[model samples]
Target: MVKHLIDEQINLNLLTPEKTLFTGEVSMVVIPAEEGELGVLPKHAPFATTLRAGEVKIYHNDNVSDVFTISGGFAEIVNNKCEIVADGILL
Candidate 1:
């Protein structure tokens, strides 16, 4: 089976206790970690971090595709996937 470009991207999911905010395949994601802004890409090393209240930036094709305002959260990165469980999201 041949893999396409989109299929090779990172899978991102942003969620809150009430609902899931976003879910898609993106090229890159910039998360607001407690330490600092952390950037995650395809094949990124597996890790997890706590997030502070800040903006979460999502990128596709090297451009800003979407942005979300999160009020603190936790992020987990594994197997080319990023799952974020936010305390709250300002929609």
Candidate 2:
């Protein structure tokens, strides 16, 4: 199958003590970094930042997405992969 830009994904891994929230690919993600809102995509430059209590938007497609309220955490991106070890998360 062919992939559209919205379907052009990057690897993602989200973890918490209770369980692994997500592990796979996503089109894009918006994180609430402490400095400001961060928009991440595939092949993005290596990034690491602190997060604040806010919304985390995981975009799956043009018309589909998942949002979560994060209490706090750290986000890091490297080699087309994004990992988030959340302090606390609310679906």
Candidate 3:
């Protein structure tokens, strides 16, 4: 089991070929995983997966959310950090 610290946030990096879209710590991230939707929090087990075409929801401070749409991409989760490389990101 992953022992997560309270008040700790997950390190998130959203990147596109053109540039890095976002970089910061978030309370959680809801991603459109290939198999299904996936929710990630701090200290999540390491995993690599393909992202589906849909909206990526990033949750931070209570009630705060950032939404982004992407066609497809890849995501890696490890050591409480998630890095996303999207094929296309809709602003």
lDDT of 1 by residue, 1-91 (tens): 1234434689999999999889999888899999999988888899999999999999886678889999998999999999999999876
- Model 3: residues with Cα > 4 Å off, grouped in runs: 1-6
Cα lDDT for residue 70, candidate 2: 82
Clashing pairs in 2: none
Clashing pairs in 1: none
What lDDT does model 3 reach?
0.86
Locate the minimum summed-lDDT window of 10 residues in model 2: 1-10
RMSD in Å for candidate 3, one decimal?
Answer: 3.0
Better of 1 and 3 by TM-score: 1
* Weakest 10 consecutive residues of candidate 3 by summed lDDT: 1-10
Q: Estimate each model's TM-score.
A: 0.89, 0.85, 0.88
Q: Give the TM-score comparing model 3 with the true structure, all chains together.
A: 0.88
lDDT of each: 0.90, 0.82, 0.86
Q: How many clashing pairs per prediction, in order? A: 0, 0, 0
lDDT accuracy of residue 56 in candidate 1? 97
In candidate 3, the residue pairs with backbone N, CA or C atoms under 3 Å apart (3 or more residues apart, or in different chains) clash, namely: none
Point to the candidate with the largest lDDT.
1
User: What ranges in model 1 sit over 4 Å off?
Assistant: 1-7
